[model samples]
Target: MDTPSYRERLNRVLRYIENHLDDSPDLEALSAVACFSPYHFHRIFSAMVGESVAAYVRRLRLERAAMQLSLSDVTITQVALAAGYDSLDAFSRAFRAQFKVLPSAYRRNDGPLEQARRYSIGQPLFYHLAPDVPPIDVQIRSFAPMWVATLRYTGPYDDCYPAWETLMAAMQTQGLLTVDTFACAVSHDNPDITPVDKCRMEVCLSLPPGMTANTLAVRNLLQDKRIYLRVIGSNSDYAVIEVNGPYSLLHPAYRSLYWQWLPQSGREPDDDPGFEVYYNSPQSTEPQDLRTGIFIPLLMG
Candidate 1:
């Protein structure tokens, strides 16, 4: 199948899976969603996505269950049922197999509840925030609502190039990208907590105002009044350093900011999801010379 057509069909099925996680979608139903024959869909999905459809669904369920455990005060039994497990024992076994951490322990120690409350309060305060180090620059800027054309990719970060290529081609065909065009990647899951195979990422290009997308998967990102305590430094905000390197090195930079910088900075993360704005294209720029700016949305004290 062609790239755009394949991405459209596969993205549709993936979105369907996300929207209906509690409901088990059989191979025939998934194949119908992908518009491929049942046998053909199974082989093609595994080959292209690097995991079988059943495995993919189960992983998503378990990972989401983990997220709920860490982020919410929901009971283990309720979480298990929401994850489509019949019993807490089965969910516990599956969670342990995947994460090697028990559900209860995960909730008490490393969950969002623990991280935010503990890190901000007593003992864990000394862990990463270093006031001796220079402050990180963060800009609080407002932006007009952006109309974007997007393609969702549901696999490893490295596997996202195909989706970008597909989206770019569609943009070029529709005459969307121009001198003022902005490009960004929207990350939907935290890699530390979510499995790489199940991570959701989108390659997006800003579209002209009032432009209508021909594809079903296109979405609008409205940020009219959205406020961000951005980590990309300026004279008024905190200090930010530019890192020109492979994308894999980004995690360390994030660690430095959150652990090494955030505590001393007196800022907390906002609800808005952080994203990367690409200043240079990977297709033309070498990995070593790539220029990408990482922005973490935050709340200033």
Candidate 2:
């Protein structure tokens, strides 16, 4: 579900459903979120979101129920109905479907994540939900022809005020980047990622077609891969975090990079190659280096 803006849309719908759960958030109300027709919302959402809308909502509610069951002293019947199950039997049935055990059993026993682990669907071998991963450095390859919108600059790396000036001007001259589907920064000798003295950052510009004709922005993209301490956390406030390292300084972030970031982000690593996409490219050593995301293969430990 890390497909750029996928979560944005999904969250909108999920939130709508949650607030209106009692009202039975049918396809019509939810479909208006992304403006897609009801006929296609479910399938498209399920495919891109890694779980069905109904399934996601159900699991979320069930997870909430488990939490409430553990904390509240209410009877199982009360907890079941509170979680939106029609009856204790139905609640128990769905609970088992999610936790693989009955609510009574779970409450009687005392394992928080144990029962939830049984139903961790779409879980990668080692992915977890890490919110703020500490920073680290690793080796990364470089590339060219990458696309980006940028604010031009010519100044010392330590004081990048001039760069910001350009960005402010651009942001003012052109409308804000909300128009761009994605944001990126193209850095000429990016300093944060590299040890370069002088630098330039080309912010990824997002605008409608034909706007580029009169702008002082660059169109082509510079491609490069960066290895950094990557932390993946949920979008929530109390997000969990996974920090990864490459032992570049001989102290690997953890025994297993996969072991560390995977379970921490609470997400399984997907097959597609993941790269750090930067909206404001860190001052990389290479002029083309924007922020390079840490993309890794979630190999089994």
Top-TM-score structure, candidate number:
1
RMSD of each: 8.4, 16.7
Candidate 1 structure lDDT: 0.65
Which run of 10 residues does model 1 get worst, by summed lDDT? 222-231
lDDT of each: 0.65, 0.46
> Any runs in candidate 2 off by more than 4 Å, and if so which?
1-7, 21-23, 111-301
Runs of candidate 1 exceeding 4 Å displacement: 1-4, 110-120, 123-146, 154-174, 214-301
Q: How do the residues 136-163 of candidate 1 rate in per-residue lDDT, one tens digit apiece?
A: 3444553334656666666687779987
TM-score of each: 0.63, 0.38
What's the CA error at residue 71 for candidate 1, in Å? Answer: 1.4
